[model samples]
Target chain A: MTPVARLSPDEERDLVVAAELGDHEARRRLVEACLPAIVALAGTFRRTSRIERRELVQEGIAGLLLATRRFDPSLGTPFWAYASYWVRKAMQELVADLARPVALSDRAVRVLATVRAARADHLRQHGAEPTTEELSRSTGLPQAQIERLQAAERTPHSLEERVDQDGVAVATVGERIADPQAEWAFDDVLDDIEVGEVRALTDLLDDRERLVIRQHFGLDEPAQTLRGIATGLGVTAERVRQIEAGALAKLRASLARPAVAVPNET
Target chain B: MEPQGTALRHDALVYDSGDEWVELGAAFLRRGLEAGEGGVVAHTRQGLSLMREALGADASEVRFVDVSAAYTRPVRTLASYHAVYAEQLRRTPSLRAVADVQFGPDPGEWDLWTGYEAAFNRSFSHLPAWVLCTYATGSLPEAVREGVWRTHPGVVSGGTWTRSALFEEPERLLRGSSAARRPMQVLRPLPVVDGVEQFRELLARELVAERMPSARVLDMLLATSEVFVNAEQHGGGVVSIRVGRADGRFACEIVDRGAGFDDPLAGYLAPRPGVGAGLWVARQLTWCIDFFTSADGFTARIVM
Candidate 1:
């Protein structure tokens, strides 16, 4: 937070020379002169909290001091421009360090980075985007990892975000997510049928016959096509369809017999 | 910048991981120390922490600076290094420094930084310093890594340093990128508001009305949403988005009015601890991801 002195070019050069010679006070003042750039550089890295921002600023100060010590006025570059790189470097390094532990190898991170750059370059260079094959060739990373890395890098969207301004939802991506058991149970179309009718079928048909009719028609499932029922029962799908038709016919005849038949049917 | 009468030695080393980098750093430091030359390592926390652990007692002797300092801009980085070497050489005629920008292949960022690496050749054409620009190949794109060879006159890999036959001076290589590129066939581009919901609705309607493949629609949805978030987060104002079929594939372009990304991987790199994958997922689902930034702002073209 120290104020940097506004020195003339010659005087600043002198201060820079002194600072480079291990002169602590001169170095401190030189660092002060670069603080504005340091603070600005610190702002570039995104921080989650006040503490982390402060930490990044502290790191920038470290860079400022290094730049002061390393600054060679003989090179004719102004102090701040020379110092900003170190400032940015320090802050970015901190951000990189504070990075979450990645499940990927450092190399994979590098390769992913490479693939991204190549694609961008290809995009910019050519108005057209590059295919994975082009990226694989350009980036020299394997296509498989390249594909995976690209997939992993996109920002996730809340399926909830897909609605229109008027709240019309074309569809949702996350609706696919739900409790399996609840999904399975709530998915049961059989629940729509009366238990009495279910029981009537239970008594009217043999076990396999009732099971095939329900399963084929998707009474128990959200909707298992007849083909799925046949596969599950290890029968031809056509045969399952025939059984389903026969079962429905029998049920119709049984129901037609009226209320007096219910007790006797069981 | 003051002119250096002496020709500078610019070299690049490519490595895959922290361990390889540490080995290179250790040797770089040893050579400088043994030869009685000033030694400095511009370390980012990524490798510095590991290098610190690896060097044990030896970590203290080297003059360490942050790699970020030189990275805010390419020219600034070179100027900083110029100062660093110029200062180091005040004690002695020759010095050796190891610095890593740790530039992973970034989309917009790499294109910007390549010029920086290219500039190094001329920036230090005079100082009698061995500037080892370290690149972690583990993270770089092949083209960007290939760029390292073009920038540096020398290349070191697998324990041997050799003159790079691939080296091309910046003048020859740093030309207009668009010259070689063929423009894509774009349909009637649609004006889009910055709002995500509107963007989604427009995109969905277009895809569905076109009877775009369901899988393609999903990819387009994710890509558009991802790019929309990027434009909102990084760019501002009215954004432009459009969807069309090109080369028998569904394609989209999302353009924003910001200066664009400083790092090409800006959208992909998880800045916060718990942030979700951003553009990376968008790129993954799509057949292609491309980006460009200029005075107009940033634009992304994606196809699937």
Candidate 2:
């Protein structure tokens, strides 16, 4: 393992000064020194098909580089702290760029227009959507072009509707409509447990105990079986079951020693 | 925040390096925050950490679930996501989630994950959300990447996405999945009712003996029966059924003498007053089901 170089605050400012003055070695060293922090800040963002963690690192380095160039030691803030926000924003900006939907070129749209006319003609004549081969034959374009047009003919789905969709069923249905089972299950689990008891149920338990109890009883997802919970937690199924038992024991013991009177005398 | 208003898009991104990995995750969370839709991220430990920091102050608004910490079984991951996502939807009207659960080192998991991706098209369809289901480019081999294009409607690359020209419906993708192919115990053609019953009995007996989960066996039985019903009703009464084990799942193909139905969404649309929901039901219950029709005849194939 290589020993990490630590720079004194003054040394860091000197490196920044050298980097800003177009000193290549200093720039490289500065970027290298901040690489881990840059990676961590960049790690704050994500990767898409166009870029990956490397790109975020690159983008972070870009931010760090820009910050290096822009930083004035007079500000007195450490370069690392100063660069962190920029490093984060750089990745976030890239993320914003990647989240966008694809736009078709005008030529493709024009080709699509001609293809649609042909498809409509084919449909009129044959009473069915034309296959890529058939559309190619009718439109005088290549089979690939026709297929591209066919794909483009469909409306471009905006991701914004991820939440705007009022008709959840219509949006979700590709083949079979999934059954709606959440609200009922949730209500069933916590419906009777008063707000006070909800906290009281877990007040004595640790985090793992709380999670295991909730998951074991299907308080979150469909009641995950012990094996299911085990898989998620990367533990043995037996371990998950044991944790659930211990948590239950604690809860039962707590409930048995009731300091508060029974609610509603149920 | 709010995605630039294109609608109903399914995009796939194949990233060459780690930097690209978080691209979709960032977009998903950022857009969710922009629109107040709420972001949910299910990813590996490394991925979750990156995303949480990326999310920053907005991170609290988002619900981040570590898939590595949670999902134990690949087959169960989709159902688990479904149940969990459905649970989240109850709290908010819409959501955008990045489900980056990791699988592999064992190529065998390829088929299971593929089936989950295909099943998810319908399972998560109505949730009023966009989910970017990611796979690393370096890890998943070419054979594994085979049906990846078909399951998704588009591909995201180079900071832009395009409609996947090769995108095939999930059913067809599953049917054509190279991973799903294996030596079949081909059975002779059988007539309706009596023959179908015999085939079911054999499948039930064999699947149980093979130590397949009993509930899964029953589910496959129901899906297979639906196809048989369709074959008998739509095509001529005679049909042949082939069963085999491929990629850790029981796969079966039913062939009928009818010309292929080209409408990929055929039985999936709303049921007519008289016509039954056979194919639709088959889709719901199976791990993966696809419809293929050619001159030889239409074949309804399923993997469970």
Top lDDT model: 1
Clashes of each: 31, 38
Candidate 2 Cα lDDT to native: 0.57
lDDT of each residue in A159-208, candidate 1, tens digit only: 34453446676654434434222332321222231121113234677887
Per-residue lDDT value at B94 in model 2: 65
Report residue B302 deviation for candidate 1 (angstroms).
33
Q: TM-scores across all candidates?
A: 0.34, 0.39
Chain A of candidate 1 scores what in TM-score?
Answer: 0.35
Question: Which digits, one per residue and each the tens of the lDDT, describe model 1 over residues B122-164?
Answer: 5455456777888887667877888888888888887688899
Specify the highest-DockQ model's number.
1
Question: Taking the tens digit of each residue's C-alpha lDDT, what string does model 2 give over B1-304?
Answer: 4333322234566677657767566866787768767578887545665675456546667776755423323333554565556556556556777776354333444565565566567544534567776767776778656556767786675657777776667777645544322324543333333555455655665555555543355456666766776677777754566666543345777888877576544444222223344554555455456666644467777876
For candidate 2, give the lDDT of residue A76.
62
Model 2 interface Cα RMSD in Å: 25.2
DockQ of 2: 0.01
